[model samples]
Target: EAKASYWRQLAMDEIRRRSEYQPNTRRARNIIFFLGDGMGISTVTAGRIYRGQRRDGSSGEEGCLSWDRFPHVSLHKTYGLDAQTSDSANTATAYLCGVKANVKTIGVDSRIKAGQCHTDKSTHVSSIMAWAQTEGLWTGLVTTTSVTHASPAGTYAHVGHRGWEGYVPNNCMVNDTKDSARQLVEESPGNEFRVILGGGRMNFINNTENDEEGLKGNRRDGRNLIEQWMKSKEGKSNASYIWSKEQLLSVDPSTTNYLLGLLGSTRLPFVMEQDKNCSSYPTLREMTEVAIKILQRGPKGFVLFVEGGLIDYAHHANRAAFALEETVGMDDAVISAMKLVDTKESLILVSADHSHAFTIGGKPERGKDILGIGGYSTDGYPITTLSYANGPGYNETKVNYTDAETTDPNFVQKATFRRYLATHGGEDIATYAIGPWSHLFSGVQDQTYIPYAISYAACFGQFAGSNCHTCKTSTG
Candidate 1:
């Protein structure tokens, strides 16, 4: 009787939600495209359950993520130009630049090959960020990874290899290509960013300067790109460079039109490892909040990209707990952004570049602890709720884990095969969206369709001559 009533309530809730849904066709005044790198379907399920379990001792199957409630959702094909499985650089290029490119390549079309610098000379494909800037919209990028990393670099840098953050790959087929940092800072100073915040301070500063965390610099060249960036913006805009949480919090968003914040030398601390009591770095939520405040000051509205890059990092390391923590951290940022923006004039998208080969199965009963080990296998060995197809945690000897610890933050779930790092899954990933033509995201779509959807909703490129002006006036 109770189960029936519970299911009935859920059905009624969904129906009410659909009944209240209104499709907004207005041209978006702003757009916030949030990418959760390597956040697969299984990852989302586990993260949702983990988030619910952490809140209270209950079966987390009933819990819903912030984006899960989004008005429209669709699965996205993550294949690249050269392979079924995709890397971040290629996948980012497809969605951000609106075209598919070879693996490990950024901001270029399929004609360019990875590691071929000379071939990329005239193949630079502009991303939506550039389009937004040209359309008089402010642009910004926020990520837990380095700003010059594959995902964020797709927005501006036209590098052949994703590894060329501060140095070129020795095996590169060409030599004249500059590193990603050089492209971001030296090549295009600030690149019209209203707010830029994330890690990878070493990529900008020189070897003589120690990062805020006392980490040694990795820049091969003696140039201090951070100093150059500051000098270029000294008399032009209200620019500020911040490296610590104190500095970030002290900035007045109203007066500051341009801001650059580097939270770590490489990647910021994982949410699970962060010192919530006295942390030097700000949380992803805090970063997003500050970014929106600064970007919102623009008269033409803004387009911001926030990435949960550490989720992919944790999955590569086979740390399920850490990955789920990062996903939840991303959800918090989405919630924060929701409160700060109006749904009528803004478009918000949450998507993943690709997926990890992580799995969440064991078939535990309802309300079971998401991170706990489930019942013993037929061989009398306990199995965890989370596992991988291949990873360093593979149990080659078939050891029994009836009493083994599986709930630690650093615990790596058992895998089927041995690998130093778990591989990415070729499976389809999800895209969730709301506001301004979000209804177009209802069916399975190619990865390239993402940028098209955003462009169509915001009236960019071919859609610039669209009926947006009339639609906006009518909607308003």
Candidate 2:
């Protein structure tokens, strides 16, 4: 018994030490921030239980690697300066720049005059990625969404509103035409980020043009950002541009200092839709691995932002099964990242930008079926084991419906939709960090401080307040 106690103490000591472990000042070389877009505690909890049920016969313990394994964990308030239920643009701006800005604004605070309305200017501010790039550190941005989408765009681009895409600009005068979506993706090139990956081919394509097949489809920007990017000095000598999985794996990492990979014209296929012969697409994990390999080649330490950006979309569609699978895929990406970089010298932070209104509540039998049996009852009624609070095509009655039965085709579980009163936990979202200044994240913290916390950890807190003061001791 005494020997067993000694081993347990040793394990506890090791865990505690891991939490407090600081990186060597001289050797520390990289910072990787992984954002799970809408992963709330319940979302993560449901994911764990789902994976556990699939693996072993029982729902695993509350503590799992994604939740329990990080050295330090904290909660974050996700409200934007203007709204309560935040969007990715504002939340991402806060995470990337450390300030609470107006909703739909990217990479800027809400003080600038944007045409008629008082909106933030993307030019006045600097993003962490920009800072890293200025310091000569190689940076990479990867997401399942468009490269210019909110989260990914926050890493580098700055704009008054996130909706600059889709709509045609009202004014076409030379000076007034700058706000057009086409120019937003390419022509405006001050903050040219080294590594760019993801979808949004539509933004780059011209409105009228035909491809080799003579199909008069929208040709990506006549400028051809992909071709220009590939032919540039960075793309030609230091980087390899790949639009498919085959090109991604075949590229020589040692010689490639930069890589431009866009798997799909839109968001990449969800995990369920992807398979081994997914030659045209790359999984989140695969992109992460390749990004790390290339970024590490830089002499200065690098900053890489990877997003499981699709989780939120699944929740929006009320597809819990798809959301859970995406979360698992995110976990796989985290594991792959940890494998390549040593915790001793790297700072790794895993967190969410905001959360979904999803929850897990159903008393399924201990070893019972996942797709429950015996006419499942919540309070007391025939219902499916899974449900959503509020979303499109939602209905409290019928408990089961098909596309033909519902008004919306995007609806996942139409009939099973019992409108439970859903709410985001007033409790801040969870944050996990390892290595260097991870200690800063212990206990509950405001959401806006995350970027500062990361910057401090990566640079040993040296550049804490130079420009990014939103995360300093005052904010905390």
The TM-score leader among the candidates is 1
Pick the lDDT winner.
Answer: 1
lDDT of 1 at 146: 93
Q: Against the true structure, candidate 2 has what lDDT? A: 0.66
Which residue runs does candidate 2 get wrong by more than 4 Å? 1-28, 55-58, 112-123, 166-168, 172-192, 210-222, 234-236, 276-279, 367-379, 383-385, 400-427, 460-476
Candidates' lDDT values, in order? 0.85, 0.66
TM-score of each: 0.94, 0.81
Tens-digit lDDT track of model 1 for 1-476? 26898889989999998999888978888999999999999999999999898865557888889999899999889999899999999999989988888999888777778876644456888788877776788889999999989999988888877888877665552555678887877554235777889999988866777876787777766778788778868777688999999998999988898888987899898988888899888888899999999889878878999999999999988899899999999999999999999988999999999999998878677877777876778877788888989888887687665424688787877888899998899999999998888898988988988988887788775566544443444433
State model 1's lDDT. 0.85
Q: List the residue pairs that clash in candidate 1.
A: 59-367
